[model samples]
Target: MTQHHQPAPAPAPAFAHAQDGTALAYQHRGQGPPLVLLAGQANDHHWWDGVREDFHTVRSTITLDLRGTGDSDKPEGPYSIDQFADDVVAVLNALGIERADVYGTSMGGRVAQSLAIRHPERIRRLVLGCTSPGGPHAVERDASVRRSLAQPDPQAVRRALADLMYSPHWQAAHPGPYRTLGDPRMPAHARRAHLIASNGHDAWSELPRVAAPTLILHGDQDRLTPPDNLPLLASRIPGARTHLFPGARHAYFEECREEAGTLVREFLLEEG
Candidate 1:
């Protein structure tokens, strides 16, 4: 017999004040141990729209808009990954959450790195997906991939993003809810700031300091943050492990949502 589950409750919008007085926006939903979701570069909480439900059944999710995205304060940013991590800390403090499991993908994963490194006590277990450490030690995306992203035509850019995000087989068979791209509502300055923060991320020397158990996930076919970074992260972060979704691309969490969710759920809920 097929199983049917009721949808998770709607998230309540809330705000937390950062040290700089920025009113960061966030939402809390469901009931269970708290799990914080961080968005990728230039994105908002909506970045997880496609996969969040997979975890909501068992974990209370807290998702925040980084300083410049979603409803968060869009201050003039020369933002840093360290700063982004602090903003998450503010949200957690506001909610009285001392520690939570953190799952961050792409640029958000970079912020998660800083979070675990800088605020070690705030994370229970860490999940980094489809992201790089970002520095001289990290593998950079191919120049061709960079050129495709730099396309001037919007349609052309969309196509390029589609190619980067999903596998060819998946793209041919499915009409994707591709939430992998940056948020559209971002202003020019906010976008630039986000890009700067993402590019400037460098936690190579600090990964070993992350005390939380870490799981690094990625798609084997990922073009943006290549799967090469998976082992790099696994090797750097003490006791870190990795899982690669075969034939999947950048948005492997969405491409293989159920399986990925199960893997993460098992990892997060397991007894230490």
Candidate 2:
């Protein structure tokens, strides 16, 4: 049987002051146990639009723009994943939240790893979506992803993003969403900093320390983050669970949005 959930009300955007005085812009869409949604590099909280309503139906959905993206203050850096983790905790503290279910995708996942390892008490559950724990042993992006990221023109970048985001099947079934993801509004310097920070992420040594209930989601056909590297995450995170969407590409979260939400809902809510 198909499960149904009420759509979340319109999003309410707000700002929380991070420890370093960076103002992280976040949006709240529901009311319940905080379900924090972190976005990948270049993207912001709006990245969760496809799945937000589903999760929001049961949990208070908290979506935040990491340091350099969206409305968040973009300080010149030398940024690290740990700094991002600290920013997340600061946001929670500013909101008077003691504990919340955390969900991070792509680069956000790296930040999530640090959060789980460093501030276990702040997380009720952990969901790592299409992200990696970078280091020497990390899996690299495929040639296609490289080619896409290397595109020089805005049109070229858009085309590459569309290709990177959707599977052929998904694109054929749903037309506009994938094409609409214009490049994330980041200046050249800020973009470089985010990439640098992402490269500096090395949490393999720290994964074993995560204490929250964890779920790992990835795409089998993901060209950006090699799906083959996912097992290392699951094996290391105490009792972490994983789900790989077949034939799904980098934007598997959208390709499998409903399933992703259901899986998270089940894990967070312990639903039957």
CA lDDT, every model vs. true structure: 0.89, 0.81
Worst 10 residues of 1 by lDDT: 1-10
Give the per-residue lDDT digits (tens) of candidate 2, residues 4-65.
56554655568998777888988876778899888887677778777677776679888888
TM-score of each: 0.95, 0.92
C-alpha-based local distance difference test score of model 1:
0.89
Off by over 4 Å in 1: 1-12
Poorest lDDT segment (10 consecutive residues) of candidate 2 = 176-185
**Any runs in candidate 2 off by more than 4 Å, and if so which?**
1-12, 179-183
Number of colliding residue pairs in each model? 0, 0
